[model samples]
Target: MNKSSGPDKNRMDVKKLVSIGIAFTLFFIAQGNILTVTDGGYSPSPKLCSTLKLVPILSLLCVVILVFVLIKMLKHKYVHFKNRELDSKTGSNGLSSMQKDNERKRPAGAKNKTIGMGTDVIKLFQQMKDDISEENTLTLGYRHLLDLACEHLDFSAGVIFIIDHNGCISLRGYSGIIPNSQENYTLELKGIVSELFERNMPRFIRDINSIPGNCQELFYGFKAAWLLPLMPQGFPVGLLIFFHKDVPKHREEYYPKLDFVNIAACWFYENHRNNRIVACENRKIEMLIKTSLAISSSLSLDDVCRILVSDIGKSFGCSYSYLLLSRGRQKEMYVQQCYSERKTPVFEPEEKIIDIENMTWLKEIIAFETPVLLGSEEIKGYPQKDKDILKISGSAGVLIAPLKHNKRLVGILVLVEQRSAERARMGKEVLDLCTALIAQASAAIENARLYSSLSDKVAQLTTMVNVGKALNSDLTLLSFFERVLDGISRNFKIQNCAILLRDFEKDELYVVSVIGHYQEDALNKRFKIGKEGITGRAAALKKTINVDDVSKDDMFIPSTGNTGSEMAIPVILNGEVVGVLDVESEDKYAFSKREEILLSSLMNQVAVAMEKIKLKQLDKERANKLSLTNTLVKKLSGTLDQSDLLANAV
Candidate 1:
C-alpha cells in the first residue's frame, strides 16, 4: 500500500506468492493433514502423521527452502518500500526530476554548490519574515537583511537606499567593508538610476567605472555591482545595491536569480513603511488634541501667543515658529512670540518689528487672509529683509498662516522648515496637514483677542467713572485742576498730564496744572492759539488730536525730551473751547481709541465743573462788595457829616 511501491513488480510478486501458497495447500491435502468440513462440526483426519519420519526427507527439505525463500522475498520487498517512501517524503532534497536525471551527469561538487545556495536563500527569507521587536528598528532590520542578502548572493558588501513617500531618497542601511573615501552619503535617482527604478528590474554593472560619476564612488573598492529596485506593488520603494570585488562570471545569471530576494525585500520594506505612516498619523492626532487643549485653556493674548508658538513648533517639527500681530490700523507687525528648535535661537521673542510695506509677500497674505507657502522660487521674489530672516533660520521653505476672523487679519503664524531636501519636499504636505490646526488656532486667537479687548474696555469704563467723580467734586479752582490732573495720571497710568486753558482775551493758551516730570518752564508755559503746540492746536480746532511719535510732529513743543507720544483733547463749554487736556508717554503709539474716548468724556465733566466753580467765586465777590458798601452808607447816615460821607465815598 506504500505510494512508492512499483505496481508491476508488486503484481508479479503477488502472483508468485499466490502460486506458492496453492502448492503448499495441495501438499497438505495429499498428506491428509488439512481439516475437513462436516455437517455438525470439523473433525481431524484419522490418518494424520505423528512424526517427521513418516514424511519424505526430500519434501521436508523443499518445505524448509520454500519458507526461507518466502521470508527473504518479503524482507526484500519491505526494504524497497521504505527506500521509496523516504525518497517521496524528502523529494530527493528538493531536486527537480530533470535535475536529478542530469545530476549524475554533472561534474563533481556542482550539486553541492546548488544545494548550498538553495539552503541560504531559504534561510534568508525565513529571517526576513521574522518578528521585529522594539529593539530592532526598521533601519536595523534593513541592515540585517542586507547582510543576509550579501551572503546569499556571494557578494562582498551591500547598501540600501529607501525612497520615502515624500519623494526623498535616503540611505537606510549598509553592510560589509565600506571604503574610507565614501564620505558622501547623499543619493538621488538620476539618469540610469532613475530608469532602473522605472523598469522595476535588477541591473548588473560589469564594471563600476562604467556607471555615472556620482554612483561610481559607491563602489570604490568593488569592480562590479548588482542594483535591485525593491518593488512591492509594481513601484520601487527602495534600491538595494550588492557590491562584488570581481565581476561575476555569469553576470546575466545573477540578475535573474534575484527575483525571490527582491520580492522579500520589497515586502519587508513596504510593511514597515506602512506601519511608520500609521504611527505618524496617530502622533499627529495626539498633537492636535493637545494643542487644541492648550489653546482653549487661556483667554489672555500673551498666553495664547506663547502656547501657539511653542505647540506649533513642537508639533510640526519646524526649525522656528513665530506669532506676529498687527497693532491697531498700522501696516506693521510685531513679533508677539517666538519658539526655536535649534540649540541657539536666532531671534528673541518680541525682538522684531516687521514693516508690511517692504514685505510684499507678507502684505499679500495679510490682505488676502489666506495661508501661503514660500519655497525657493517664491522666496526669491521677496524682499531682502524677508530673505535675510529666512536665511537666519537656515530654512529652505516657509509656511505663513493668517490668523483672522470675520475677514479681519488679527495676526499671522510662521512655520519654517530647515535646509533639508527631505524637509523641503515635505513643505506642501506639511502645509496640508497643518491646515486644520491653523484654522482652529485662528479662531482661538481671535477669541482671545476679543476677550482681552473686552477686559480693557471694562477697565477703561471703570477709570472713566472714577475720574468723573474727581472732576465733579466740590473744590476750589486750583484744587479742582490739581485733582483732575491727579485722577488722569493715576487712572490712565500716564506719566505726564496737564490742563492747558485758553486765554481768549490774550489769544493764547496757558498751562493750568501739570503732573509728572514737567519742566519749570512748562508749568506756566503759554502758546499762541492755532499757531503753537499740540495742545494749542487742539484748542484752536476744538477737536481731539493724537501724535503717536511726538518727535515726528512739526508742531510738537516738548515738555520733556523723554516723551515719545502725546494725545490732546479740547474741553468744551457752551459750544466754546474752555481748555485742552494733554497726555504724554515715553512709548510710541501708547494710546488707543478707547483711551481717547474716556479722556474726552472726562474733559467734558472738567469743563462743567470749572464753570460751576467760576460762578460760585463771582457770587462771593459780589456779596463782599455789597456788605462793604452797606457798612459805609450806615456810618455816613449815623454821623450826619457831609465831609465824612464824601471822604468815605472818595
Candidate 2:
C-alpha cells in the first residue's frame, strides 16, 4: 500500500514466478510419461518420451532464468527500500536537530542585544567623562549635562536644580523651552521633590493630570516627566528633571536607560560640587589679597575703616555694614563707621558710649572670640536697645564677627543682609571666610594705631630737644622765660599760656610769665597752693590736671579770659614741684594725652634752665662784693690811717 510495504510485495512476486515454472515442468513430464523411463529401459515409447524429456529441460531452463531475474529484482528492491528508510530517519532527525539549534541560538541573540545596550551606555559615560574634564566652569558643566541628557534620553526639555546650604533648591541650568515662570513651578513641586529625595528614588509620571491642579500647569505641554534625584554620598545634592512633550516609542527601554542617566547625573553633581569648592576657595583668596592691599595702602584709621567696610560689603553682597571700635580705659564701644544701601535716615539714635557688658549677646561674642549670626525673628526677642539697632539696619539677617588682636577685642564687624536670600544661606564656609578677613583687618588696624602713636611720641621728643637747645644758650632769666613761653605757644597752638612759679615761703603760686590776651592781668596774679585754681592744684599735687571744659570743672577758676578747656602740668626739680605750666583753649576737649605729655617734658627742661640761671646770678653778685672789699682795703693801706681803715671796714 505504501512505499515502505513495496519491498514485501516484490518478494511475493518472485516466489510466484518460481512456483509457475515448477508447475509447467511437472505437467509436461506427466503427459509424456517421462517418469516411465525407468521401466522403458526395455520398451521404448518413441516421440512422446523424447518430447517430455525436452519439455523437462525447457521448464528447467525457464525456471533458472526466472529465479535469476527474481533474485536481481529482489536485491534491487531491497537496496531501494533500505535507502528510502535511511533517508526517512535522517529527515526526522534533521527536523528535531533544527528545532534544538533554534532553541540554542535564541539566548545568544538576546545576549547580543543586551551587550549592545551596555555598549551604548558605556559610550555615553565616556562622552560625559570627557565633557567633565573639558569644562572649566560649573555652569558649562551643568549645561553640557542637560544637553547630553536631552539628546540621548529623548527629553524635550530639562532643568537642573542645585541645593543650597539651607536645603533650598534653585535652578542652576536648563535646556530647551523652560518657561520664565519656572520659579513658581519649582515652588509648587518642592513638596514632591522633597518626598522623592527623602526616598532616594526616581519617579516617572505618565499622566500630567495625576499631578495637583495647581502644579499641573507646570507640565501643561508635557505628557510625561522623569524626576531623577542626584544623590551623592547618599544625600540629595541636586535634582535632574526631564520632560517629554509626547510619549516616546519603546517606552519600556527608557526604564533601563535611566540607570545610565542616573550614574551620569551623579558624576555631574560631584564634578559641580568640586568646582564650587575650588571657586569658593579662589574667591576667598582673591578677597584676602584685595583686602590686604586696601588696608595697607593707607595709614589713617578712617581710611582703613572705610576700606574694610566697603570691601566686606561688596564681598558678601550685604545691604549694610558698620565697624564698632572699643575706646577709653573702660573699653566702651563706639560706631566708628557705617554704610547702608538705602538713603533713609537711621532709625535708632546714635550712641556715644556702648555698654558692651550690659549686652549679653555682644559679651558672649567677645568672650568666645567667635562670630554670631542672628535672624530678624531672633533679634525681636533681644534687649530693646539691640532690637532697635537691628531694626534700624533694616536687616533680615545679621552677622557679627569680632575683631581681636593679641587676645584683646579690638572691634566688631557687623554685616546686614536685607534682600539677598543667597547671603542668608551663609554656612560654615562663609563664616570661615569672614573670620579670616576679620583677622587680617584687625592686625592691620592694630599696626596702624601703633604706628600713629609712635610717630606722635617721636615728634614730641623732637620738640622737647629743640626747646632745650634754645633755652641752654646764653640768655638772661627774663629772656629765657620769654623764649620758653614763645616756644610753648608756637608749638602747642595754644593762644593762652602762662608759667606759675611756686613761692614756697609764702605757700602760694604766682604767674612768673604770661603770653596771651590777658598777659598784663595774669603776669602778677597770685593764688594759695592746695586751695585755689587748676595751676595751684597742679603745683600742690605735683601732677598734671586736664579739664575738657574749664567752665564745667569745679577746680577751674577761669581768670585768664573765658577759657573752655585747660591743661596744667607741674614742673618738678629734685623731686619738688617748683612751678606749674598752664595752657588754655577756647574749645572743649582741646587737650589730648600726647599734648599733655609733651607739655610736661618741656616744663622739665624749663625748670632745669631756671635753676642754672639762679646759680649764675648768685656768682655775679658775690664777685661784685669781693671786688668792692679789695678796693677799699687797698685805699686804706696806702693812707696808713688806722681810724680811716676801721671806718672803711665798718
Candidate 3:
C-alpha cells in the first residue's frame, strides 16, 4: 500500500529509486571489466580492495545525482505542457471556474454545457461581424446576410423587407424558393410586412395553414415558419421571414441566438440605409452649391431666371418649372423664365403674365414665407386658373418655394412633377432641405433685381441726356421733334412711337412726328380731346396713362394695328397741356413703369423746344418790322416831298 502523495511527489520518488538502480549497475560493470583486464587472476591487496569499494560507492552517488537532476528537468517539462493544455481548454475563465469549483461543487456536465453555449454565441457574433464587414455585402444587397442566417439556423427559405420612414415597404432580398406574383412586386403598408413591423416581435408558427392567403403561397410545402422584426431603434425598419420544412429540435435553445441574428441584421440594414441617406444628402448639398453658383453667374434677371429654372428642373426631377417674379408690390406675377423636361412650353407667350388676385393658390403661396408642397388631391381645391395651368403643364404634384428678400415676397419658384406609377412623390424632407437653398437663391435674386433696376435707371438717364442735347441743338423745330421720336424709339426699344400736338383752338390732337411702322394716314390722324384715342385721353386728362394690353383697353385707338401695348404721357408748358407723347410695342406688357418715366422726361424736352422756337420766331418778326420802318423813314427824308411821305405812310 502506498501513502497517498500528489503526482509530483510520487514521480520524484520513482525517479530517485530508478537513478539508484542505474548507478549500482554502472559501478558493477566498471569493476567487472577492470578485474578481467587486471594481472591474470592475481589476488588483490587489502588496501586495493578497500579503495575499490570506496570508489564504487562514490561513482554510484554521482550517477544517482545526475540521473535525478535529469528526471526533475523532464518532470518540469511535462508539468508545463499540461498547464498549457488546461489553459487552452478553459480559456481566461479557467482560474475563475477553478475557484468556483472549489467554492461549491457543481455537476461537470452543466459546466460543460454552459461553456459550449457561450462559445457558440461568441462564434455566431464573430461570424456575423465578419460577414457584415465585407464591402460587397453593402453594395450587393443583404441577400448574403439572409443566406447566412438561414444557413446558421437551418431554415429552408428566408426573405427580408425594408421599410422607409413613409411606411413604404420594399423587398430588399430573398433566398430559397418562394412564389412570386404581381401583388408581391411591392409590399404595401397594409400587408404582412407592416403587420410584422407593427408587432415588433419574433413570432413562431407551428402550422403553415394559419398564414394569409396572399402570403401562403410563399411558404408552400413548408411545415413551420418564423418571423423576426429588426427594430434597432424601438421601431421596426425591417422584417425577416423564414420557413422550415421540419420543426427544429432545438427550437427553444435557438431563440436567443435567432434574436441575436435579428439584432445583427438590423444593425447591418440600418448602417446600409444610413450610408445611402448620407450619400443622397451629399448629392443634394452639391446641387445646392451648383445652383448658388448659377445664380451668381450673372446680374441680369432674365439670365438668372433662365439658369434657375433649368437647374431646379433637372435636380428636382420636375416635369416643368417656372420662375415667376412679382410686379413690385402689385398682386401680379409673370413667368420670367420656364423649363420643360418634355421639350414643350408650359405657357404661351401671351399667357406668361399671371394675375395673382385671380389665382387663390398663387396668393396663398405668396403669403407663406416658406415652400409649400401639394399633392394632386390638394391641388384640385385650387382656383380654376391655377388648375388649368397645372393641368396644361401635366403636373400631378406641385412644390412652390417662396422667394423672399428683405421681409418682402419677391417671387415664387414653381416646380411641377408629373404623374407616374414608377416615380416617387416629393417628400417633406425636400422642402426642409430646400429651405436654405431657397433662402440663398432669394438673396441672389434680389441682388440681381437691384442690379437690373440700377442699370435701367442709368439707361434712362442716358436717354434723357441724349434727348436734351438733340432738342437743344441748332436744328429746326420739325427736325428737333423728329430727333425726339427717334431717340425715344431707339432708347426704349419700341417699334411704334408718335408725337401728337393738341390744337388749342380746335380741341383736337393731331400727330406731329412719327417713327416705326405707322400707316400712311397716321401722319394726319386726328382725335377729339377727352373722347378719342390714348393720346387724346392723355391730352384731356393731362396725365400719363399706361395700357398693358391695348387690345383689352377700350380707350386705346391704334394708329397701327400691330401695337399690343401703349403708353401716353401729356406734354405740358406753363401748367397747360400742349401735346402728347405716345409709345407703343408689338408685345403685350412690353411697356413698364421705367419706360413711362423715360418717355415723360423726353416729352418735357419737347415742350421746352416748342417754347424756344415760338419765342425765336416772335423776335425775328419784330426785327424785320423795325428794319422796314427805318427804310421808310430814310426814303421819306430823301424825297422831301409830302406825296412821298404819304405813300410811305400808306
The candidate maximizing TM-score is 3
Query: What is the per-residue lDDT of model 1 for residues 1-650, given as tens digits with 9 covering 90 to 100?
Result: 21212344446656787798699878877766775567887676655545345569757866876676677568656655654564454332232222233234333443334323544554455555563322234567778777777776688898877775446565667888653442435456676678776665567776666544354565678887887776665666677888888877855445323644564565566566676567567756876786677566656777877887887677667878788787775477777778888856655322465666666666777675666776544565666676675343335678888877677777888887765543343344456566666667777787777777786666566656654565456567878788778776776678899888888899888987888998988867899888999988898889999888787899999887698889999999999997898899988777766688778877887788788788878877899889879989898769988888878766
Ranking by lDDT: 3, 1, 2
* Cα misplacement distance, residue 101 of candidate 1 (Å): 28
Q: Single out the weakest 10-residue window by summed lDDT for candidate 2.
A: 91-100
- TM-scores of the models, in the given order? 0.57, 0.47, 0.58
Q: Scored by Cα lDDT, where does model 1 land?
A: 0.69
Over 4 Å off, model 2: 1-355, 358-360, 367-370, 385-397, 415-433, 476-499, 502-542, 549-565, 573-577, 583-606, 617-650
Superposing all C-alpha atoms, what RMSD in Å does each candidate have to the true structure?
Answer: 13.8, 23.5, 15.7
TM-score-based ranking: 3, 1, 2
What tens-digit string does per-residue lDDT give for candidate 3 at 1-650?
Answer: 22222355456777787898789767755666323344676444444565577787788886887687667667656654654574464232123222232223322232223233554565665577557756443424467766777777678888776664445455657778654633433355554545655656567778765643345566678888787767765666666778888887655554545555665675566666676577558857886786677556656777777777787677667788888888875577778889998989788766877776776656667677888877655666666666775343335578888888887887788888875412534555566666767888787788788878787777677766765676456566677778777766675667888888888899999888898888999987999998998888888888999887888878787778788888889999999999888888888778776677767876776688788876766777899889889988899768888887878766
lDDT of 3 at 648: 74
If both were scored by TM-score, which would come out higher, candidate 1 or candidate 3? 3
The collision pairs in model 1 are none
